[model samples]
Target: MNIAKNMEAIFVAAIVIASATSFATAAVSTPVIAVKAEASAMQTVTVTAKRLTAAEKAAL
Candidate 1:
Protein backbone atom coordinates (compact mmCIF):
# COMPACT_ATOMS: atom_id res chain seq x y z
CA MET A 1 0.00 0.00 0.00
CA ASN A 2 2.84 2.40 0.82
CA ILE A 3 4.55 1.68 -2.50
CA ALA A 4 1.34 2.33 -4.40
CA LYS A 5 0.87 5.68 -2.64
CA ASN A 6 4.47 6.64 -3.40
CA MET A 7 3.99 5.82 -7.09
CA GLU A 8 0.82 7.92 -7.22
CA ALA A 9 2.57 10.91 -5.62
CA ILE A 10 5.45 10.65 -8.10
CA PHE A 11 3.06 10.51 -11.03
CA VAL A 12 1.21 13.64 -9.85
CA ALA A 13 4.52 15.48 -9.34
CA ALA A 14 5.64 14.60 -12.84
CA ILE A 15 2.38 15.87 -14.32
CA VAL A 16 2.60 19.16 -12.40
CA ILE A 17 6.19 19.70 -13.50
CA ALA A 18 5.37 18.97 -17.15
CA SER A 19 2.36 21.34 -17.16
CA ALA A 20 4.36 24.18 -15.54
CA THR A 21 7.13 23.80 -18.11
CA SER A 22 4.66 23.86 -21.03
CA PHE A 23 2.91 26.99 -19.68
CA ALA A 24 6.22 28.79 -19.19
CA THR A 25 7.38 27.94 -22.70
CA ALA A 26 4.10 29.14 -24.27
CA ALA A 27 4.05 32.41 -22.31
CA VAL A 28 7.61 33.46 -23.25
CA SER A 29 7.49 32.57 -26.96
CA THR A 30 7.70 35.09 -29.82
CA PRO A 31 5.41 35.11 -32.86
CA VAL A 32 6.83 34.59 -36.35
CA ILE A 33 5.93 37.33 -38.89
CA ALA A 34 6.24 36.50 -42.60
CA VAL A 35 6.39 40.13 -43.73
CA LYS A 36 8.42 42.15 -41.28
CA ALA A 37 8.83 45.79 -42.43
CA GLU A 38 11.43 46.51 -39.76
CA ALA A 39 13.70 43.76 -41.08
CA SER A 40 13.21 44.82 -44.72
CA ALA A 41 14.30 48.38 -43.95
CA MET A 42 17.81 47.15 -43.09
CA GLN A 43 18.37 45.37 -46.42
CA THR A 44 20.86 46.46 -49.12
CA VAL A 45 20.20 46.80 -52.87
CA THR A 46 22.52 45.51 -55.63
CA VAL A 47 22.83 46.99 -59.16
CA THR A 48 24.71 45.78 -62.29
CA ALA A 49 25.47 47.31 -65.67
CA LYS A 50 26.31 45.53 -68.96
CA ARG A 51 28.20 46.76 -71.98
CA LEU A 52 26.26 47.48 -75.18
CA THR A 53 26.95 45.98 -78.67
CA ALA A 54 29.22 47.77 -81.20
CA ALA A 55 26.20 49.14 -83.20
CA GLU A 56 24.35 50.13 -80.03
CA LYS A 57 27.42 51.86 -78.67
CA ALA A 58 27.78 53.87 -81.90
CA ALA A 59 24.16 55.06 -81.64
CA LEU A 60 24.65 56.40 -78.09
Candidate 2:
Protein backbone atom coordinates (compact mmCIF):
# COMPACT_ATOMS: atom_id res chain seq x y z
CA MET A 1 0.00 0.00 0.00
CA ASN A 2 2.80 2.39 0.77
CA ILE A 3 4.48 1.66 -2.53
CA ALA A 4 1.20 2.09 -4.34
CA LYS A 5 0.63 5.50 -2.78
CA ASN A 6 4.17 6.60 -3.64
CA MET A 7 3.72 5.49 -7.25
CA GLU A 8 0.46 7.35 -7.47
CA ALA A 9 2.03 10.53 -6.11
CA ILE A 10 4.84 10.30 -8.65
CA PHE A 11 2.43 9.66 -11.50
CA VAL A 12 0.28 12.60 -10.55
CA ALA A 13 3.32 14.86 -10.32
CA ALA A 14 4.54 13.73 -13.72
CA ILE A 15 1.18 14.41 -15.31
CA VAL A 16 0.99 17.87 -13.77
CA ILE A 17 4.48 18.74 -14.99
CA ALA A 18 3.82 17.37 -18.47
CA SER A 19 0.59 19.37 -18.77
CA ALA A 20 2.31 22.54 -17.61
CA THR A 21 5.12 22.21 -20.14
CA SER A 22 2.74 21.36 -22.96
CA PHE A 23 0.65 24.43 -22.32
CA ALA A 24 3.74 26.64 -22.06
CA THR A 25 5.15 25.33 -25.34
CA ALA A 26 1.80 25.57 -27.12
CA ALA A 27 1.44 29.23 -26.22
CA VAL A 28 4.99 30.04 -27.30
CA SER A 29 4.84 28.15 -30.66
CA THR A 30 1.47 29.43 -31.89
CA PRO A 31 1.20 32.42 -34.23
CA VAL A 32 -1.12 35.10 -32.87
CA ILE A 33 -2.67 38.21 -34.37
CA ALA A 34 -1.08 41.48 -33.30
CA VAL A 35 -2.52 44.96 -33.04
CA LYS A 36 -1.17 47.73 -35.27
CA ALA A 37 -1.52 51.47 -35.09
CA GLU A 38 -1.89 52.13 -38.86
CA ALA A 39 -4.31 49.29 -39.50
CA SER A 40 -6.65 49.77 -36.53
CA ALA A 41 -5.77 53.25 -35.22
CA MET A 42 -5.61 51.90 -31.71
CA GLN A 43 -2.57 53.98 -30.90
CA THR A 44 -3.29 54.65 -27.27
CA VAL A 45 -5.16 52.59 -24.72
CA THR A 46 -5.73 52.80 -21.01
CA VAL A 47 -6.51 50.01 -18.62
CA THR A 48 -7.91 50.32 -15.12
CA ALA A 49 -8.65 47.78 -12.46
CA LYS A 50 -10.20 47.78 -9.04
CA ARG A 51 -7.78 47.84 -6.18
CA LEU A 52 -7.97 45.01 -3.68
CA THR A 53 -8.31 45.85 -0.03
CA ALA A 54 -5.90 44.79 2.70
CA ALA A 55 -8.28 42.07 3.82
CA GLU A 56 -8.34 40.58 0.31
CA LYS A 57 -4.57 40.49 0.21
CA ALA A 58 -4.42 38.77 3.56
CA ALA A 59 -6.98 36.19 2.49
CA LEU A 60 -4.96 35.29 -0.59
- Please tell me which predicted candidate would have the highest TM-score against the true structure: 1
Tens digit of lDDT per residue, candidate 1, span 1-60? Answer: 687769989999999999999998899768866975787579897878887999999999
Clashing pairs in 2: none
Give lDDT: candidate 1, residue 53: 95
RMSD of each: 14.9, 10.2
What's model 1's overall lDDT? 0.87
Please give the CA lDDT of all the candidate structures.
Answer: 0.87, 0.86
lDDT of 2 by residue, 9-45 (tens): 8999999999999989888865888965675665776
Clashing pairs in 1: none
Error of 1 at 16 (Å): 0.1
Worst 10 residues of 1 by lDDT: 32-41
